[model samples]
Every structure is written in structure tokens, then in C-alpha cells.
Target: MLISGIHSRPKYAGLRVDRSGTHHIILSDTPRDIARMVEGLEPAPGPTEVWTVVGACTVTAAEERGPDGSVVRRAFRSRPLMFDMLGHRLARESMGLRLYAIGEEAFLWDVAALARSFGVDGDEIQLDHAGSERRRVFCVHCRAMTENVRTNIVACVGCGAHLTVRDHFSKRLAAFMGVQADAEVRGDLPPVEEIFR
Candidate 1:
């Protein structure tokens, strides 16, 4: 929790293998995150599946394969394709699924939201933050999202309002709320810094 008074801010407990889960599904947005994720889950006791957005990742066959060569893994060149496949897999599979995700804040919540839509319980999902600290900001004025924001204040993509990124987070939106920064004074703005990253 970054903000002392805000419970909405997410606090991450790093990924751990679910010992009793019959099936495991692990997901990550970037190569660096997934590499760190595989450590405790390489020789998983049961069937395991790894999904990653491999946009610029260089993956080897051994990396995709379990030590015993039984684990199943898939890489997608795009987030949409991987998300689509994830939805399908969740809908089709009926039992013993434990979902895990490791990546940036937005990516972590995105996976949780998707799993929630599929009737997955919060206790059944685990999230660990990795990679960049950049955030997805939702402009309160226009209800538009500003992706990968690294600064405390940013211009709204839709309404052109200068927004102040708040600690308040919405799992449904998978983003932090951004209110008009200079709403009171027309030209008075806070100093913008690369605080998120």
C-alpha cells in the first residue's frame, strides 16, 4: 500500500505454487516477469500451463517445456490474442484451476478481472507485481484511460484535463483514478515527475 490511508491501493504478495491445485495457469505480460515466475513452479506436481505476451521476447524450447517435458505453454504475439485464448480456456475447463499472474500492476489486475468474470474466486488467484511501475490511469472527467502513465500529473487523453493520479484503484477498471489536477486554478499545476516508474 503506497498511500497510508488508502485501502484501494494494491499490495502484492509474491507468487507461490499452490500445492493442492490439480491444474495451474500462470500468466505474465513480459519476458522478465515470466522468467522470475517460473522458479518455484518449474517441476509442478500437476499439469501446468504458462501464457505470456511474447511481443519482443526470445523464447527457447526448453523454456517452454517442463523439465519432464509435460507442462504445456503458449506464447502470443499480442495481448488481445492471449486474453481471448485465456477466456476460452477458462470457459472450457471446468475444474481444479488455480490462476497466477506476475507482471505490471495493470496486467496483474487485468488478469484478475478476467478471471473474476469467469466465476473465479479471489482466493483462487494470486498476483505478483514485476517489471515497470507505470500505471493505467482513468480520467474521472471523461472516463477515458491513459495507458502507461509514469508521472503524477498527466493530460487526459479524452477531455484534455490535467489529471492528478490518485492512489484509489478500481479492480473493475484495472486502473487508478485521475482527477483534474488544476481544477481549482486554471493554470496552476503540480510539478510532473516520473514517479510511477
Candidate 2:
């Protein structure tokens, strides 16, 4: 309904909007003549605050199964992941749409994507990049999958907590091996350069 006159711009794989004026936004595909009019026509608000939506995403074209029957893909996480998220967030936030997170602790922002698809002006999306990029710790009991292709942290839908790969999958293996469960992996671990690409 609010999608008219609101131009949609591609923010990475996501969407952004540019509002020209209150009159430009159309409520329907049909010409304004047949469009239903809502009462109380007031000039839309002025340039509100901007917001950002930052997240990691793995891009892969259709692929084939590997030797073990698992599809193979490229790893685009780490620095690239940060850059991608920043690009999309900046594009949309520049147009005055606030970034709203779908889940409190996850990268699932489908609602934000939908809002961007349909033009809806909103308030600020205060951006904050706190916390270190330390290795995430996944709960062994949570049955959460750790994705090495995209990011080090995985959000647990059950408990809404963030976890890391070693703290998760590798830890699961360690538990099965009857090894000590250390929050952080110790010596003999591969160098960071050799580990993450």
C-alpha cells in the first residue's frame, strides 16, 4: 500500500527506498483515480533518523554435490562479511528507513526486508558495534549448527544466545572424544591466517 512513488533500491540482496514526497507515494498499482483514499491526509513527517542493518550472508549460485554428496561453496565470511553488511545497511539507512531486527540476537531481519520492500518511513536505528570478534561459543546441548562459510557466531533460536564454531561443533567433537571442554581452544591450534581465509 505504501509502496507507490517509493522507489526500491537494491541494498546488496536486500532493498532500500527513496521517498520523494507524500504525494509521490501511491497506495496501489491502479491510477490514483481508483485508489482507495484514507481519511486525515496530513503531510508526511520530515527527514527522520537513519538506521543500519548489519549481518553476514553467504552467496552461492546453484551448485553440485561434492565427493561426499555435500554441495560445495565459497567462504565469504570474516572481513568480507563485515563489508557486505555495512554496504546494505548504509544504502537503506541513508534513505531514512530505520533498521529493525526480526530476532533479538540473530541475523534474521526478514521484517526489515519486507518493510523496505513496502515503503514505510520510520525513526532512527541507533547503530552500535560493540563486543569483540572473539570466537563464538555454542551450547553443546543446543543442537545448533555452526556455519564456517559465513560467520563465526551462530544464534540459538532456543535460547537467543550467540555462539562460536569451536565452542559449538568442534566442541561437540571434543565431547565425543572425551577431551577437555575449553571455552577457547588452546595450543597446537592452527594459526589464524591458516585457519580463516
Candidate 3:
């Protein structure tokens, strides 16, 4: 048997490449998940920085020392502060930059959308989640957007249609596709089940 197989490479082998750039780490309030994301990410040859978006909580000692070495931590008491900071940082056009985001599903996608708007390459950005699954869904019937949707079946606020949230996610809408839940039998409804539990 051969000593080395074709697919024996490490999971992060591709990320370990030597490059000249800054690594930007975005973390949420979950301590355990934050630690997990930063466990084995060592700094590249260039400068490294970490920015954490947290609520009114004290940063732990481990979080202070980021993947590279030191961390620049920021606390936000309101949503405006979070949006402002993310916008300001992403507005700066820099080619030698890598972005890593770890947070709730909604928060992570929000940050990702901002990063993409700034022309950040998909290959250069990494996203991870920490908290429960809260989804955003777009109603096809009335063109309405729903936020913090926790169930697979939701009633559309716009046209009063019972929407069945599909698994297909739309990147452009930043939400899951929602269709008429009762389209099959008109009056027949499926049993309700708790999602993101």
C-alpha cells in the first residue's frame, strides 16, 4: 500500500499557504464558539488583526489573545454601532486582506453581505455560526421580507398566505425561498414543528 493517499492532506492545508496580507477576524458574543473558530488559525507572514463584535459582556483572557497574538475588541450596546463599524472597515479597499466571521446565522449573513458589497472575493472570506438558527425568508406571493423566522411554516404578513419555507437559499435575497404552504390541497395544512430548536 502507498504510504500517502491522494486525499490525506489536512483540512486547513489550503489556508496554510504563505501570503502577504492582513487577517481580519470577526467574532460574536458566544465564547465557546469563538474559541473553537480561533483554535488553530495561526497568523500568516503579514500583519494580523482581530475585531470582535460583542454585546455588553467582558472579554475573556483567551479571547484577548487572538489567533495571531493580540486582539482589538469592541463592544456594542446597539445595532447601529455594529453596522457602522462593519461598514467603516469594509469600505476600505484593500487587496491584501482576509476576512473571517463567526456569529449567529443572521448576523453572519449580514456581515457577509456587507463584505461582498465591498467587492471582497468569496475565496478570501470565511463564515462560521455560533448561536441558534434564525432564518430570513422572502415571500414569493407579496414580495415581503420576514426576519427572525424560526419555523418552517410561516404566515406571510403581506398577502396572508401560509408560506412553506424551502431549503433553497437565495444569495441575492439573503433569505430562504418561501412559497404557499397550502398549495398542495388548498385547505390541508401540515403539522407544525419547531425549527432552530
Candidate 4:
């Protein structure tokens, strides 16, 4: 399906939908409302992007006519609903803050909890996952501040889940967000473990 962007973000991400008939309607809905749209369809909300995959569909987001309107679209593969369900389960079980030594063969951080905290509002979760090969590591670089910390976690060339350096830069950010990583860091002046517990 080709989903021409009637109205969307300045930037976009790739996503897949399982259902064959559902329309990829892009409306002027808030992030929270977007979440609500697919909340019950998928039991656990994993990050996902909405794309039309079966037919040529255009959803006109409510807006006044303007000369400089921006529109963007991308192609996404459609999968069975069961695939999404499986991905959600695996994502919940094995995603998040997976770290490793710079050149070590084995994984460093056991990332079950990290996946639990990160979320997507009816869109694809930004975190990357392991691919077929196993020669890379996921790493997170964080910048801490008094008000908020920035975290950037990413899967490596071999496919590993990156940490959210922006979200988990400091213990304070973790604590404020009520995540385990923050709680562990709050006890110590410097972080003993780079990842959230």
C-alpha cells in the first residue's frame, strides 16, 4: 500500500502494520490520542510507525490551506498480525540497555528491564535489535544535567539495542521518570552501572 503523507512530521520513521484492511489514517491527533488509536489492538504498546501497505490511501489531516505545506511518505512491508504480536513479546522480554565491552564477543548488559521502560506511541520503538549475526554490541552515550539528562542508545553494526543516553544520562532523570536505572544511580555520586537497573 502506498500512503502519501497528507500531513505528518518534518521527519519520519519506517513501520509495518499486520492488519490487511485497516486504513493508515493520518489525522491531526495528539501523541496521546495516537496511542489510544491502537492501544487495544496490540496488547503491549511497542514503538511503531503507521504506514499504509495494501492500497493507495491518503488521510487529510485537518488544516487550513497553506502554500508551504510539508508531506513525506515511506514504504513499509506488511506482516501478519501474529508477527507484530510476537515482536511485541520478544521486545518486552529481550529489549533495552544492552551493553558490551568495546570488542568483547559476549553481551555485557542483560537488557530485559530496559525494554520494559521504553515505549512507542503506536509507532515503532526507536531501539534497534540483534540481527542474524552476533559480532557487534549496543552502546549508550549519556549527557547529564541538573534538570534533565540526554541519552542516545543504539544497536551496533551487528544489531544490539542501544541505551537511551538522553533519558538515562543521570540518576536524577531516572528517578524523576521512575525508572530502575535512575534509582540505582541516585544512590551513588557517579554511576557504577551505566545502564538503569
Tens-digit per-residue lDDT, 1-197, candidate 2: 01123222112221122233212211111112211132222223322221122223553322333354322222233333433543554555434334322111123222333333445324322111112222323355564433322333345444444433342223212111011123365332322231222
Which run of 10 residues does model 2 get worst, by summed lDDT?
26-35
The TM-scores, one per candidate, come to: 0.89, 0.19, 0.72, 0.17
The sequence of per-residue lDDT tens digits that candidate 3 reaches over residues 1-197 is 11123342112211231254455544453434443455444433444545555455453323244344555555564444666766787787567677666655556666667778888756767666656776777898888988778876888878888888776666566676678878878967777666754
Selected candidate, larger lDDT, 2 vs 3: 3
Worst 10 residues of 3 by lDDT: 8-17
Reference-based lDDT, each prediction: 0.81, 0.29, 0.60, 0.25
In order of TM-score, best first, we have: 1, 3, 2, 4
Which candidate number maximizes TM-score? 1
User: Candidate 4, residues 110-170: lDDT per residue as tens digits?
Assistant: 1212323444222222211221112122233222211112222222222222222222112
**Residue 3 displacement (Å), model 2:** 40
lDDT of 2 at 164: 34
Q: How close is candidate 2 to the true structure, as a TM-score?
A: 0.19
lDDT of 2 at 113: 33
